[model samples]
Target: MGSVQRAMRLLETVAAHERGAPAKQLARQAGLALPTTYHLLRTLVHEGYLRRDSGLFHLGDAAERLSRRVARQRRRSAVTETLAHWHDVIGAPLYCARYRDGEIEVVGVADSQENPAVGEWADFRATGHAHAIGQCLLSQLDEEARRDHLARHPVQSLTPYTVEDEGAFLRRLAAARHGEPVLERQEYALGTVCAAIPIRIGTIVATVAVSLPVHQADQLLPTAHRLQAEIGRAPGVLALSFSI
Candidate 1:
């Protein structure tokens, strides 16, 4: 077998043992000669992919990092596919974002030339009160979490229609009925209107949104409700929140 295959066999053998395996036991399990196994084990340990302790070997920190990196890539691919599918079905640019660690993050977006995405004239993260996506996410957070986020990215007017007062914004969020989509008009960007719906997966808060020119204002609420219904029917595909 090639060096990589041989190394993988050793790693698989080590992984099969819950308490770790001695060099001789690993060599037997991997079907490699004792000297070759020792050399491979030394290399693995030196490279930090395997840890040697007392006479046994175990998977190391490097292996954990590799696994996490692979998982993150897989999650990104899945999220991209989901967003693109919805964008095609809705005939508007679709956006997905999450509230993580006291901040808003726009994770994925899918748009086409016929239906271009909204321009980010202002930092979306800092203007949560001025856009549908951010407002939807903020509405899902608890009082303390909401307060914490607003403290850092306090309510500010990005356009003439933006909500610039913190108390008025908080009261508006409070009065919003559950599961209702949040709508904005020239709030974040002039001549653009948007709508967002909450995508709650357990305790995690996320949002799915769409933006269009002011001329399409009449279609905003209808599209938002349709998107909400689509999400309700197949929440598994709409939710991009993943375990890190």
Candidate 2:
């Protein structure tokens, strides 16, 4: 086996011991020579992936951090796969976003060259009031959080159809019911219409959105409703992916 693979096997043996394992014990479990095991253990200790004390080796803080990062990466991959699948199913660009750390974050987008995603004419983070994705995410938050976000990113018009009045926007948000889709017509960009649905994953405020040409405006609401129904029927599959 390669040196790196052998070293990893030794580390795995040490980890399985929980409390710790002596060099000789790890070598026996990993089928490696005692000298080789000692060399790898020493190197791992120096690299912070293993900790040695009283002639025994244990998994270290760096190993735990690496495990967490791998988990996060797997979760992100699942989310992207789900969005891409929906993009193909709905035949439109799909978007996934969240309201994290008091800012709008577009986590991922699924689009092709022919059916491209919306171009960022204005900063999405600053123009939340003008986009369906932002409005749907903001609607899920409590009034205090919504106010706080608007305080930072004041509601401004990105297009003539955009809602510039904060009071009117708040009223619209109040009228929206859970599970319904939010629709916008040329609000964020001309010649495009978008729809977003509030994805309730635990206490987090997240959204899934889709966009199409203005000529296909009639398909906007029906497609959005179809998206909602699909989500409802298979909530655990797509919605749980969003939580990750």
Q: Assess each prediction's global lDDT (C-alpha) against the native.
A: 0.87, 0.87
lDDT of 1: 0.87
Clashing residue pairs, candidate 2? Answer: none
lDDT of 2 at 84: 81
lDDT per residue, candidate 1, 1-244, as tens digits?
5999999999889989879999999999899999999999999999999998888899999987887898888877787887788888899998988888888889889999999998788888999999999999999987787788889989887778988699999988887778889998999899899999987888778888988889999999999988777677767654543554
For model 2, how big is the CA root-mean-square deviation?
A: 2.1
Best candidate per TM-score, number? 2
Give candidate 1's error at residue 237 in angstroms: 4.4
* Candidate 2 segments whose C-alpha is farther than 4 A from its true place: 17-19, 53-56, 237-244
User: Where is model 1 more than 4 Å wrong at Cα?
Assistant: 16-19, 28-31, 237-240
The alpha-carbon deviation from the true structure for residue 129 of candidate 2, after best TM-score superposition, in angstroms, is 0.8
